[model samples]
Target: MNRRGLWSVRWRSAVVWVWCSFCLLTLASLTLRYIVLYIHPDHDTHRERWCPPEPVESDECYSWRPVLLPHATCGCTRRILIRHTCSEDLSPKMWDGQANSTCDPDGSVRGPQQLVMSISTPFLTPKRLATLSYTITQVNELYRGWVLRVYTRVNKHSLPSLCSLVCAHPNLDVCDITAMSETANTVHHAAWRWGVVGDPLVSTWALRYLHHALLPRDAHALTQFINSNKCWHLMKDHPTHSHSVLGSGLLAGKTSWGLSELTGIRKRILLTRHVVEEEQVFRDMVTPVIGRDVMTHDSLTCYTSAGAVPFPSRRSPGQWVGMPIPTLTNSPQNQNKSHKNATDIMPPQLKVFSVKYNSKVNTTDGFQIIKNQADNDDVNEMEREHINRKNGIPRCPHSCRPPLHPNWDYC
Candidate 1:
């Protein structure tokens, strides 16, 4: 019994040790998973806990608590700025005069008769807020017939600040898409599903099409599209190209510039007089700067010309006509002085507009417009030439003339 019993006991001991080790490892793995999940919860699961299953009018439906980061100060908590209940109505409203108009002789409802322009941005920083406000003022002043709508991502707490910044213009409506769900049956939900998640290239495309679809059949309207980063201004009237769609061509392919063609596509804000019948044709004509087939390198149509709206160019000098021009100074004394007298230096039109809003924003931090050295020099030279011409002096031929001297009257 000595040799056989000893071997059998050793084998049984090995089997028991292996099974105990396996059970311990499994228990440890499950514990670690639970710990990780407790520390950093899944976003979808958290959303489901708060967001209502159906549209609700209560503010509690969109309530969100501030999230504190680990080891961070209590003041450094991250808070969602805007949140709206699913039932909250944020639809665009027609201008006052258009409200009374009928669709046809039969007194039926028609699509939007007024020009509807829209712009979308996920983040609404201070700079974007100012640009948007200024654009709205300009649109209201220049094109009284058009209606502008703004779509951005923000939470309930931050929305009032934005609305106040924009002065809550009647012709413009600001819509928030932060709480939009793809599964919802609302118009915004449909557009949200159409958009490619996390892709900024086509972020505004779906909303633009949605607005067009809501318009009256064969309606004659103009769509002025741009992103939050870009500013739009009416430089001059282009009645010739008013009926046709226009966009930029400088960025047709990836090789054209180091930037993606999609960036150029954002610059291609179309101004169309009539809505097209087909969706594909409408997209192609509305956004000709970048091809519809984003995966392929198909030839893109560029429409940069006199009639086309001027887009910010990475390679060329920036235009100052429609841009905010801020005096640059490093001296703290000068900066303080500039800030104090900001309203005095503003254009008469802007001064008048600002009075209407009674905006509380510090003028010094109103809007920051960035321009390159070449652009600054070009703008300076143009101003000098204008002064000389006004005083009955001829423009100096820079090519033939020597370097400018203090005593020189002409080249």
Candidate 2:
């Protein structure tokens, strides 16, 4: 072969090798790119999935199942001890005497016979719900702590105003006043309180709890929100009660706290007053504790002038939230028997928690007189002061003002 022919073959071989290398590199780059993008997945589309420690098999398929974690904060788990009003004044003369007469109230109060949804997903599972329940309880604790601080600082006459200041603004730091009032109302009128005198401490505790559950957990975040009276950067319409409903079902397995037998002496008496006649005296005694508004209606009465009557309005057949108060150590084991009511698989839950006391955040509102305070400083200045007060830090660097330019021009 000629020299030129030999050189041409060598060059062509070199060119082919280069082309092959380029194609391989391009393919690898594309593969790496796909792996980087697709392997772990993105936050926007991922759903939370908890794999059970052990596998569960049924029918043809098998999957891991989550172990039931006992309700942590509350008392025992075997029987969910609930408070209720069993009897009250049944005299026809009283406002609610007509309806306070039935144990079941035609089932409307029990809510739908079962949980409409399954409790399997991360949203509905025990752990997540327990955490949320804990958070709610913690918030209540913080509110109490704050109230104690305010109460200590001021006298009785000044309490309401200070409470108003602490709870006044519906800003980012605090929960909505309307919601707080509603919770206070609920606690005051709980079945346990029907015929009993009201206790201010219970109201205060409930107020703190419901509000704290809806507010931020971080102290700084809470402080910023409270000072501003709004959810962090939320709009005007953002304070609706639905915020509580958002994760409630997932955590508590249901939204409403089912009002059952009204077991407590006060509540039972109040509830009983509705079904049986001549329980009138009991109702009167209980009325003050639950507040006058609650006493007017019969605990067993299904319907009211307001609308169609539902279940007992209090008791319902829904999954109870959290474990019973005391840790379920050696408590009777609830082995599921075949004949057991399928519905009974999930029992009523009463969640109890150790109170966390944060010395900031107050939550008393409604019936509060609004007042104008002197705006001696701008919002900016107030914000700075707030930061300074919350955390002992200065806004600007210390002792560092800009130096003056001596010569703007040749003097």
Candidate 3:
């Protein structure tokens, strides 16, 4: 071979070797990243570590485990993606940005303040289980500093699946209500009785049980700060009666005072022998504290039989956007049946949108409200863009469009 040809051959061989080496290095980097994320060195240690018991007086001992999401952190860029959605990412603005800045390394927000939620169900069907999982995931994503307490009455067969769901998230705790005699004997019995007879009183008893059971040790401090109510509470109210409709009868409050007031309502319900609704109780408790100024006509719209309605634009800022539960069925027969009543069965998928707040609004008073509104706006914009792209619609360029005139013809 000629000397020039030999030099060309050697150079070609060197390029091929370098390319192979680069590919190998890239593969190794990706593999290491995957291992760091999914198979953490401390994963086994964290899983094996004993969970601390709740500092409360109760026969039923429950422990809380940290919800570990690789993408989520106590910073501006934290995001948690839901499992079954169309790869739609949660808005970083959903959580209070100020709170994020002050968050501890452990992902907890500073101060004695925390959000608490309780979800209970008598039976855990596949559909109900998915809904429960979605709800918990949404809570974890939206409220980073919040603690979710889940109580389920599932059989031994379903226990592992429930545990898998709970263990994956941070700031989440689960208690098998059926496993505890204290709860099983009283609240479980009441729930079953109410399920059969549609007795409102019996249902109220079950709610009361959860209200007290799910409270943190520092629940007493909830009402201490009148102007700056620290603890927020939300409880999922499942249908206890056979005839009751599947609705988002979620009981929520800006402060834990609403939870504490349940005791007073329980006494009132006993004295009057009246069928007092839980929604009515919540409204009576919260209306005075949050004030009539913040509430709109549709503020209590989720209390309706139709489930979660679209949040009105004029509604109070900082209120949670109502998420409609989608009818998720895998069976062909069920899908066909669901399609017939698609309007009724399948509501619009959960979309979090922000409401515009007055610029003059006090930042101290409406910090969370403003943050949520901004988050919703960003999420809504992203969702709209996603839909447009799916439908082959071109997104209008932000540079060409002015903020004041969104519908300008030129844009």
Task: For each candidate, give its TM-score against the true structure.
Answer: 0.29, 0.17, 0.35
The stretch of ten residues in a row with the least summed lDDT in candidate 2 is 229-238
Measured on C-alpha atoms, candidate 3 has an lDDT of 0.34
Best by lDDT: 3
Give one digit per residue, the lDDT tens place, for model 2 in 79-178: 1111122242222222222322111121112112111110111111222223223342333333322211100112344333323323321110211112
Query: Which ranges of candidate 1 are over 4 A from the true structure?
Result: 1-111, 165-167, 179-411
Clash count in backbone of candidate 3: 5
Q: In candidate 1, what are the lDDT values of residues 55-166, reduced to their tens digit? A: 3345566632232221111122222112233554322221223322111110111112223344455556544444455455545443443444555556665565555633
How accurate locally, in lDDT, is each candidate?
Answer: 0.32, 0.24, 0.34
**Top candidate by TM-score:** 3
RMSD of candidates 1 onward, in order? 24.9, 27.2, 27.0
The TM-score measured for candidate 2 stands at 0.17
Better candidate by TM-score, 1 or 3 = 3
CA deviation > 4 Å runs, candidate 3: 1-114, 179-249, 254-276, 280-320, 331-348, 351-411
Clash totals, every prediction: 9, 63, 5
Off by over 4 Å in 2: 1-127, 138-213, 216-411
- Candidate 3, residues 1-411: lDDT per residue as tens digits? 555654787888998999999999999998887688576643222121121212333432322222224322222222222211233223333234433211122222211234444455666665555555555554443343455555556577666555555455555445444444343334432232122111111111112222222111112112122123222223222222213221223333332323334444434322322233433433464333433212111223224422221221222212222223445554645433422222222223332221123332233321222334323443355565565445333433333233454442111
